[model samples]
Target chain A: MKFNILIFTHATATHYPMNYLASIGSYAIMVREVFKKPTKWRIMKSLILKEIDDLIFGSLGIIIFISFFIGGVVAIQTALNISNPLIPRNLIGFATRQSVILEFAPTFTSIIMAGKVGSYITSSIGTMRVTEQIDALEVMGVNSLNYLVFPKIVAMFFYPFAVAIAMYIGILGGWIAGVFGGFSSSADFVEGLQLDFIPYHVTYSFIKSVVFAFVIATVPSYHGYYMKGGALEVGKAATVSFVWTSVVIIILNYVLTQLMLG
Target chain B: MIEVKDLHKAFDGSPVLKGISTVFEKGKTNLIIGQSGSGKTVFMKCLLGLIIPDSGTICYEGQIYSQLTPEQQRDLRQEMGMVFQGSALFDSMTVEGNVMFPLEMFARQSRSEMQDRVEFVLRRVNLADAHKKYPAEISGGMQKRVAIARAIVMNPKYLFCDEPNSGLDPRTAILIDNLIQEITREYNITTVINTHDMNSVMEIGEKIVFLKDGIKEWEGTNRDIFRTDNEAVSNFVYSSELFKKVRQMYLEERD
Candidate 1:
């Protein structure tokens, strides 16, 4: 297993530069595309509206539903286990905050977003490509990249950020139910949470989400736009997009964590 | 008013378009017709610079596409309107939105001006009510109409249609043909159509270039093509049972 892992790492190291270069160029092109269209005001209007819709449907709904179930389980488990006398009573709050900002907000929010935003970017762009609407844009003298991919990038930035915020709130709900409402003293938990909570952590979380938004926007759009075959390829594109984006996000999180900590 | 000179294209290792030279005329429905795999579509895409030729010159009126920089080539490309084989309308957008898309991106038109143009084109295509409907909500014929509407909304100097009648019913096919022909005459647009459809050939082919096996086999108009004695074209045009019977009648009249 170790040997296999080493081989895989070497393989990734070889491929990383090409992907990195392509990605940076993709972002530059996306920025140029935004300038090719109407002013920022109209683009932002559409993007925000779309993002709000995506967040509400995607992460917000999932977080509320998932939080209640997970929260209930965590609460019962915490109540059953916390019989140690010397262990700090407020440790649960620290665990909750760290978990929310680091893992739950970025990772869980993405899982929900896979079905909502990622799949959407895939199918919509895939359909457009299959139908030849992309070609139509090119023939009409409109920059196909700008019109198709630009608003999506902007929309992505807003939607995933919204989803991350919702995921953070959902984690808090879980914490409240598990730490205070069910097991620990409310005062102890709240005080512990306030004491450890740093503004930098929040910034880190937001920064990760923004980067994730770029990944979600660009990867799915690229897959969809270059989609080949017929009806079946659309579904395949979406599936590939979900898998790749998820993997990239995890790797990115690890890198971000290393930078932020060290 | 488009000139293609000694154009060639290859994929992987196999050549798809040989040295093809043809002038697609202005103010007429000039056609590039061939069987499937005859490289007509490849030729049209080469004309549009979507597929660059291996070594050749495509001069749009007077400008040589091969010699121009990429930016200048892109600028020249913007003067074109294309109706795709599948009626490539944006699925997320309503018909009106799709029509107005080019205007919003390329022109400095105000919102109301764009709206008016979208409505005008949609009305021209007999899709006024359908404008509010998403591409998915519309029928295939309606989708094609909307595609045509979007293509012509810009009043392009060059109009390119690739297999415009595919997946369309016979009656709808004629309507699309007439619409395209009328638009071509009305705007005096240098209209280029790629098709092997005999019906279309008879209807609006003022100039036609025929291809066989990546090479130009014949070039003539619909009326002139019938009277020509080219053996390959005769075999192609008279291969059908219906055309065979029609040929017999023509021979009897000549006798």
Candidate 2:
């Protein structure tokens, strides 16, 4: 029994690297397939419209609500942390703007969308896989990936719009909280927002949003399109997709920030 | 006609389809009957080109499948339609949309033309009333009818149904069987069905292939099945007491 346990452990330890590599390889192939032999324009047009409604339009409510509140909290925290009189009260607006724009609006909102949009993509595709609808498409000579995943990718091209809105709302919320809470004056806050306002920071944020948007669209889809088994498996795939998509987004966030902002 | 020559498949080094050969004639309802784990699904999937056989050739109307280019193979698939066992209709689409999917993808007609074709096929399958209803809102029998409508909407030359009557009542199952047979005859399609339902076999099986342990155990018509002395075939076809009595009656009547 001891020898058997040791062998089983050793086998499992060796299997993970191969499994991870295989997953990455398969994801690359799936992405390629998604771009090949496009579906009919008329059909794909309608599909893209529907996906935009689901992935972007449908997500606006939550993104706006969270952005407003998180921005307020960041301003309050920065104001409270100022112990020395040397620090200007304008620093509240500056801190909130940088935090919301640089990380919260783009990366944090994406993590939430991973739970929201990513799970939706995974569950829908995984359910199709379970019910053999994917096989049905293949039998009908339809490119299932193009029919399913391509539209999502196209819809997410506009994801940066959502992030841009989040950035605006978050800064507004910070102004409201800082002024109303007596943490900082409105004039001081506005001046701080205008201080050292680099135009390239917006570019950096948008760039990260684009890469994260692609990760959001494709990673969950990869989890979904390749899932096996039945209804239980669909639920499991959704969970797995959320975890992996968030992980990829975070890692990409770090790498991209280091490359572009360092 | 679809001709299989020495088809073989294996999973995890364990062979499921050892060596099998048969011909499914066009304009006839060909039934593949077997107990579970007999490679019936695998065999049908192979015919549908969903599964690639490890060895052997599947020739569809004198065109060898394996020899065709990728484009050619996809074009061949356009000529084929499949009805999965669970009535694998698209959940999001209404009945009309589900039936109209293949047409939308490949048909070059106007929207009105596609709609008209969908209506005609739905009417043909006796599902004209359920146009806007989703698959989940319909009965299993209605779902099966919708599946049949979708399968034939393109006027495919070959139709493959994997257990078209798996979860329906006997009466509904009979209706589905008859519908498939009527369409097969009407279109002169090479219809291949994988089923374990004895009623389906007796009702519409123009040619029957019995498989056991990954091998073809018998091949004959329905009448030939009743008269066949092969013990495995007999044991399977006459497994129920009711079928035993039916077989006995058949023999006595013949005598």
Candidate 3:
């Protein structure tokens, strides 16, 4: 039993970074290796095309589907809360615009991506590192860092913008649910929406989405790229990626809001 | 050729490869053999520039490794091929895609030309039909063969295998060993394999290195190994019951 402990401990000692500065250097290494193999996978090209694909084939569904559901629920809830028909019944649509465009679309969709893109990056790279696929790439003269991370990062830069667009489109479904569904009048809802919100708020939403996209894509990859041991380590790295990325998103959102919001 | 001089590698505060020095000859199989945790992997990694040594120099063909630029190092990496223990095939790609990966990265071949080369190498490794299969869909032995095929796909000058026979049965292990040696000889590539299997040492260990507790305890070919009067070598080799019985039978016949 004691012998097992000793061997296990000894095994652990190998995984430690050899120097204090290794942490910083490894990230730079990760960035380079992930980005290096541009031509091999048609990575740069694929990134642009994938965003188009996500926009046209896939992401719109998420926005429309989520918005309609949320909008329907909001309409039902607001209909009951309002007793006075004389008051501005269009307050619901005005409130919906801020929630959907400023907060819900960008922040909520990013949370969704934390599950999709985040898990994919972490597991794929973590598996590659553990199974010696990354080492294989290294020996083959392929810059694993450049090859792996570049496509992911470039893809990330655009994916959130598309997602933000999706979320913005999604809020319209909610808007129609209020006005066309008789919960609120069309003129009042339209007037209420245009008058109350900042157009620059859309810019903030896009910027925030871009920021969230980076954190989601890179942090998960960082955890996976340095994964040691085997399948178990890959699993642990994926789990840790989720936890750390969630924490980073919250922290980054708070910071960006404070710094970017006028 | 690769020369590792006074290599000192440690894990946390304790040492794994402690001031080890060795040379691997060009155009021959250099076998580094040891039990698990004997630092053979570290030595191999150090030579390949995967891990940096604390206070030693790795001279690859007399060029100090650490001094090379990233591009030069990447170009240098093109000169070598590696076969990992897990066979490390890219799960997302087909076998042809896996073989074509290095070539696509380093060479300026057209798509059809690359396809031709991939087929040629796949044929060479007797994997002509497995080109379209994903790695997970293949058998373990087949995966190792695909790995070997991928390693040699680039026609590399040097080859490194980390426990080439790790998870295979005895027959499969011997087959992989012979394939490696045959490929090494055919290409005259400097082949280094890190393994603990005695079967490998006796079978194709043209120039063998025995590492114990991170030290080079013995270095010899299979022919000289049986006759050497070194106790550490004898203890390690003859500790196997199968080896002991075989040795006794040979001795009895000699008498």
RMSD of 2: 4.6
Per residue, candidate 2 scores C-alpha lDDT tens digits across B123-197 of 999998999999999999999999999999999999999999998999999999999999999999999999999
Off by over 4 Å in 2: A1-18
Best by DockQ, which number? 2
For model 2, state the Cα shift of residue A156 in Å. Answer: 0.6
Question: What would the C-alpha RMSD of candidate 3 be, to one decimal place?
Answer: 4.9
Interface RMSD, candidate 1? 9.1
Q: What is the lDDT, from 0 to 100, of the residue B243 in candidate 2?
A: 92
TM-score quality measure for candidate 3: 0.89
> Which whole-number lDDT from 0 to 100 does residue B125 have in model 2?
95
Per-residue CA lDDT of candidate 1, range A9-122, in tens? 323433585655554454455455545634345654775576556644445666566645554444445455768887766656555656666666666676656656778888
Higher-ranked by DockQ: 1 or 3: 3
Task: Give the DockQ of candidate 2.
Answer: 0.50
Each model's C-alpha lDDT? 0.74, 0.91, 0.76
Going through the candidates in order, their DockQ values are 0.44, 0.50, 0.49
- TM for every model, in the order presented, reads 0.87, 0.96, 0.89
lDDT of 2 by residue, A122-230 (tens): 9999898789898899889888889999999999999999999999999999999999999999999999999999999999999999999999999999878877678
Output the chain A TM-score of model 1. 0.76
